[model samples]
Target: MAIELKPTEALKLWHDVNLDLVRDGETDLTTRQMTILLTIYLDPPPHTVRGLAKKLAVTKPVITRALDTMGKAGLVTRRRDEADRRNVIIQRTVQGSLYLDRLSDLIIARAHALRP
Candidate 1:
């Protein structure tokens, strides 16, 4: 089902979710971290630091730092690219999937509540 929401409603929903995340004592991810997380989960595989940096219009160090932080949180994993040993491939973890799933559910619920 498709649910359309005004920009104000969408922002409000995001704000609500962010508040709940903070209240739950969850690590509040930075905007950059969340962008990387969502990109890794939603986009096609074979994600690399270079690719992410290019896609996000940031520097390699930026992506590396975000990945390092997310890796420590078990939200993402990095492995040697067998095809090219020089490359590090970013992979999604079950924990990250569950986190995104919960976030998605929260957003959907908020959207539903906003429906007239």
Candidate 2:
């Protein structure tokens, strides 16, 4: 069933999840890194550095730096596009999917503990 949350409840849940993540010692992602990660996972495919920069209203270098960090974390990968050797395509990984799934579960558990 879907649970409707007021703004305060939503904010509290967000805070609780962040705290839990910190306690778990998961790699702390910056706001920009999180944005880029979510954009790659949640958005449609054929994701390119240029496309992501345009989508996030940031520069190519900004995306590249974030990707470098996330790549080391095994959250995302980049490869030259076969169709266009000059273009780099961003790809998702099993580790990245599992990481997001765990975070979702953490948020859900925190939300369930909230009083109506």
Candidate 3:
């Protein structure tokens, strides 16, 4: 499971996955957007605008903007916390999960296809 790659190999793998993403005509996520999505999915529950901003070391507006784009894409949804009306909690959706699943498959396939 732990595979090491040389710098060139790593770049090749990255390039291949990116090419596939472009070819598939899927949502083109910015680096920041992808980082936010990955953090939300890979991290624990109760994700909030404040929390993500702090964790990612970005401003709340920055998080909000990325969420806005991802929200429209159905990659994420937000709801005001009933307990604390000020907090916006981020929630995952079926579409978001499927998108990541496909992305994961693409990365794995591209990694396997890398020249040794």
Candidate 4:
């Protein structure tokens, strides 16, 4: 079944999900980091810093900085591609998958509880 919510309800769901993340005592990614994380997981692989920067319309340095933070959190790993050493490939982690799973649950729960 399709889900539907008013604009206020949608924002409320987002707020609640984000608030839960903040209180979860885990790695709370910044908005940029979250966007990058989602894009990486939602899209197909062979993710490169150059590709992400271009996709997000940002600079290579900006993507690098975000990756650095996420990398420290063990959410992602990067390595120089063997085929093309110039490209830094971004790989997913178990922790990152679990994090998004928890986030998905929170969003679903909040959406279900939205006021009619």
Best by TM-score: 3
Question: Which one wins by TM-score: 2 or 3?
Answer: 3
- Candidate 2: segments with Cα more than 4 A from true spot: 1-4
* Clashing residue pairs in candidate 2 (N, C-alpha, C atoms within 3 angstroms): none
Segments in model 1 whose C-alpha atoms lie over 4 Å from true places: 1-3
lDDT of 4 by residue, 1-116 (tens): 88777788888888988788888877667787899999999999989998998998989898999999999989999988999888889999999999889888888788778864
Please give the CA lDDT of all the candidate structures. 0.91, 0.91, 0.91, 0.88
Error of 4 at 101 (Å): 1.0
Q: Residue 88, candidate 3: how far off, in angstroms?
A: 0.8
- Which runs in model 4 stand beyond 4 Å of their true positions? none
lDDT of 2 by residue, 1-69 (tens): 987989999899889988987898866899899889988889999899999999999999999999999
- Candidate 3 lDDT over 6-86, as tens digits, reads 998999998998898888886789888999998889999899998999998999999999999999999999999999998
**Residue by residue across 6-112, what tens digits does model 1's lDDT show?**
79988988888787778878867999999999999999998999999999999999999999999999999999999899999999999999999998988777667
Ranking by TM-score: 3, 4, 1, 2
Among all windows of 10 consecutive residues in model 3, the one with the lowest summed lDDT is: 107-116
